[model samples]
Target: MANQYDRNPFAEEEEVNPFANNNTGSVPAASNSRLSPLPPEPVGFDYGRTVDIPLDSDRSASQNLKKKEKELQAKEADLRRREQYVAFATYLGLVLCLFWNIIAITTAWIKGEGVTIWLLALIYFIAGVPGGYVLWYRPLYRAFRTDSALSFGWFFMFYMLHIAFCVFAAVAPPVVFKGKSLAGILPAVDVLSGNTLVGIFYFIGFGLFCLESVVSIWVIQQVYMYFRGSGKQNELRREAARGALRAAV
Candidate 1:
């Protein structure tokens, strides 16, 4: 009873399997990834190394995409700069018009015939200079600084008012008497024979102002389009994701 498994020295051994080191094809492999020994190569088998197909097309496509990205960045920078300059120029033109109005008012005041013109110009200048500094110029500057259109509200309002202003200035016919802008609207009219010089100045201002209003409307629309476009949104999202990934790493 105690001699069990002790009498096999003289007995024949069991048959060995050729694939015992590996599992049978029908059976599942081990959980680990180490491979078992493979069979020897058959006679006349080529055993040639794998032919590597060069990815020249893919590399070229990537290079082209990178070049296009650089071009796009350059274009955006140029556009932002140009837009800022245009905005500044428009504001300068508006300020010049304000100055012109003040000069006209002063000339009328000197002639003692344009009390209305003088008072209105003075009031507008007093209110407008500070108001424009706060609402118009500051907002516009902030928008361009960050490449944003969030400040278009003030710009739109300003330009709309300017459009009406152009028409208002045009209709008030400067009937110059003794070198004055003796002009008025309904319920309050200043009737006087016009001097040729005042007529020329008023007409020129009217034309310039009308053209400026049209241009300002167009510029604000362009700014709105740039702000709402999906291109910038997607680009910003991608940049954010990249930043997050970098932080994680």
Candidate 2:
């Protein structure tokens, strides 16, 4: 209502933008982000770099592990083959010993002088052969196949007992340990003057027992040395301790 150019000293002054373009509209903060492009990344920045760094050491270590695994497999295979050969020899010996013992016992029965020995031999054959296989030989085989320390321990224990039995048989003592021997050296000598055929059978039986004892001793030595070298004793102790703990639990 006042004059158009007149100034009101009590009124607030409006700000003037020296460089503002009249054609452009005011932008809001939220809309500014959408309107503007992101700043360009530095020339050699690691923004686009992959997360995983390729390392030669990691690749080489993996290769080495695979190589060791292969070598171990090859060694185990060779050991298995050697064990097979030994097992074959052992089987042959067992069969021969049993066969010879049978022949000796049969000869004793026919002669009638060593029928008591024949009875003992019959029991021994029935129990010993199968017991040897189940108690010792199979355990030995399993130990080799599985690399089981426990199985090896069982084999050693039973095989030692078998060796002792072999020694007793070779001695051929009469009336000792339920007549363990078929026709020991004593009977062979006693009957030699009277019956040549029976004496020969008895002597041969004694000799075979001696041979078996020697072979058993040798085989045990070989197996034991290998077992020790393989460092299975520590593993055996660990397994035993674990078993005890489990039992307690």
Candidate 3:
């Protein structure tokens, strides 16, 4: 029974330990042996190492250029082969003309008439073979080879005349100009009643002439269409302008 005023109510009470003085079995402290060594400083990355990468620009460019060159060569070869058909057609027409004239000469000789016409035909044959190549075929060939619009224009002019010649030679109208027409369809039809053999020869000649005419017509149409469709007309104008400028200069 202590006096109430002598007790301080805010003071903490002291805790008592029952085993403070007991030393027969003691607890051990926590050990660091089982804890893992902070995982070995995470091995620093080798940022200083450098790697080289190769980019062969020149090799790539050379390969690309070679590929383009091959393509161009193939295209040019195809163009050459394609354009040569027209030349071949021209040669064929000339050969047919040669044979047709020969037949005409033989027929005239057999008939013992039309000597003047056969002489004229002989002269044409002598000139036309080489002349055909030089005049029309050569120009067209040069136009194809060099892409020359002037050459194309020359070919057109000469080839048109050639086509007209073929038509007249094929039809063989009466010689209003000079002599009886070349041995052609009309002449063959006229001679058929008299000499069957001569008429047959004339018809053969007429057939050759007609073949030549047809070939000439087809070639001219094809070439003219190609000229128009392939924009060569524009090129022709440009070339003309260039020539005029050069002449003026």
Candidate 4:
């Protein structure tokens, strides 16, 4: 019998392919035309490159400004101390002069020495120079230098008042005495007895001294307040900037 399935000579047993229909190939030799060496690796863009720029100038400027501020603060403190010391010294000097006047007046009264009284009055008049320098000139100088509210007008007005009072003291007795040593003695005694006119003069002088002292103390307080306020504000600003820098870091 002739078999239905026959090994055809042309087929030669249909040589089997191990990878038949698997879509597996030699990958077309990785065509140089299509691959093109990966486009030279894209030049390796870096996001963390450090840039060099000189910040020393800016840093130096900031440091210099801080130093200048510190220097100014130190100077202000020194000036305030000096002003207070001078004020205390002047107060002491004025008190001493007051004592000297009191002694001279008592001696003149007890001894009834007219020449001595006149000499004492002259000494009081001369004492005005030191008093005026302390109460008027020095204070005004400090006020101007410190840009204080204690104005030259305040000094001038008080100084004029002092001068007017002194003039009254000098002339009042002569006018009231009327060329009699006994009359001079009576007027002097009236002053010691607390006559209304003499009392008023004393009150005005005391008021002027009190006003000067008050103004000086007020100015010192104002300077201290300003410095403290500025320091607090600067500290707050510096702390805020530091917080921002820390966050970035």
Instruction: Provide the TM-score for each candidate, comma-separated.
Output: 0.57, 0.64, 0.64, 0.34
Runs of candidate 3 exceeding 4 Å displacement: 1-76, 176-181, 241-249
TM-score of decoy 1: 0.57
Ranking by TM-score: 2, 3, 1, 4
Error of 1 at 148 (Å): 4.0
Error of 2 at 195 (Å): 1.0
Q: Write the per-residue lDDT of candidate 3 for residues 1-249, one digit (tens) a residue.
A: 898788688998888897675564585656665866666565658787786655687789889999999998887667556656865776676767766767766676668665666667777787778878888888888888887888899998988887787778778887742323466788788777878887887787777777877877877777777678668899999988999999999
Per-model CA lDDT versus the true structure: 0.60, 0.77, 0.76, 0.52
RMSD of each: 20.0, 18.4, 11.6, 19.1
Per-residue lDDT of candidate 4, residues 1-249 (tens digit): 868796666865667888766554845443455644555556656877887868998899999999999999898778757755654554454454344444444454454545655455555546765666676657556654654444443554554555454334433345523311211223444554545444333344444444444544554454446445445436545666887999999
How big is the positional error of residue 241 in model 3, measured in Å on the Cα after superposition? 4.6
Which 10-residue window in model 1 sums to the lowest lDDT?
182-191
lDDT (C-alpha) at residue 242 in model 3? 93
Worst 10 residues of 4 by lDDT: 176-185
Cα lDDT of model 2 by residue, 1-249, tens digit: 889889999999999998986755575445454566789975787778788767988999999999999999898678767765675476567656766777876776777644665666677778877888898888998998898999999998998998888787777666653342465677678768878987898788788877888878878887887788889988988999999999999
The window of 10 residues in a row where model 3 has the poorest summed lDDT is: 175-184
Q: If the candidates were sorted by their lDDT against the true structure, best first, what order would they fall in?
A: 2, 3, 1, 4
Count clashes in each candidate, considering only residues at least 3 apart in sequence or on different chains. 0, 1, 0, 0
Q: Pairs clashing in candidate 3?
A: none
Candidate 4 or 2, higher lDDT: 2
